[model samples]
Target: MEDINLTIQKGEFAAIVGPSGCGKSTILRMIAGLETPDTGEVLAEQEIIQRPSPDRMMIFQEHALYPWLTVEENVGFGLELKSVSKSERKTRVESVLKKVGLDGFQSYYPSQLSGGMRQLGLAV
Candidate 1:
């Protein structure tokens, strides 16, 4: 992974593909601020990423939603952590759920939803 210079434009999706242990996850971890490069820097939007940020998230292929929380709770968890007002959080969560076609499933738990629905819940 030495001298790896990559630029991912905003709104542009990129994928890193390679054999196992070839540092693909390491690169993603660096970008997510979960790991630090010993010799180089990882930047997002021109800012050096030194810690985990709400603006940046790593949603693994597996289900990452909290099993104990309902869909609405899982979707609003980040906003809750940021101290967003309850009303605002509700509004935003409802908006996102509506957009994702999960508006009526807010009370459902992760295990209750289908695989695709669970993934969408995680994405929200």
Candidate 2:
């Protein structure tokens, strides 16, 4: 990896393009706090990233999945880990799913969904 500096402000879309395995994802992981730099800093606002948090979310190139969980369960998994109640989690998860164009496939498993739906599932 070479030294590079870039800033993406709030309400903006930023894409990194380069050859495969050229540390494109490495940069995102550092920003998302999934990986630490050997030296230097990764900050969200004024806070230094140290670990994964809801405030700093990441969805990788590969569709992230809990193989044993259903579509609904996978979408709601984050809130579940935070100990949110079932009713509220359900409500939020459903809303998010719908926003990502998954309006009626909640009960489907990952195996039953198409690649696009699986990607949509991960987005929710």
Candidate 3:
């Protein structure tokens, strides 16, 4: 992973593909602020990423949502951890649900959603 220089623009999508143990997950972890580089630095929005941030996230391949929690609950889990106001959490959850076409399925559990829906919930 030496001398790796990459920039992902806002609204742009990028993928890191390589054989196993090729540092793909390492790079993602650094960007997510879960890990730090030994020498260089990782920056997001022109600010050094010193720790995990609410604005940065990583969605793994497997379903990460809690099966017992409803769609809205799972989507708002992070906000809940941050101690966001319940009213604001609800509003933001609703907005994101609508954006991902899961607006009316807020009460549905993860098991009730299809694979694609579960994946979208992860992104939410």
Who wins the lDDT comparison? 3
* CA shift of 59, model 3, Å: 1.6
Between prediction 1 and prediction 2, the one with superior lDDT is: 1
- Which candidate achieves the best TM-score against the true structure? 3
Output the worst ten-in-a-row residue range by lDDT, candidate 1. 52-61
Better TM-score candidate (1, 3): 3
Q: Write the per-residue lDDT of candidate 1 for residues 1-124, one digit (tens) a residue.
A: 6889999898998999999999999998898889899997999988999998978877677998999999999999999999999999999999999988999999999989999999888766
Residue pairs clashing in model 3 are: none
- Best-to-worst TM-score order: 3, 2, 1
Model 3 residue 80 distance off true place after TM-score fit, in angstroms: 4.5
Off by over 4 Å in 2: 66-69, 77-92
Deviation of model 3 at 94, angstroms: 1.7
Return the TM-score for each candidate structure. 0.71, 0.72, 0.76
lDDT at 3, model 3: 89
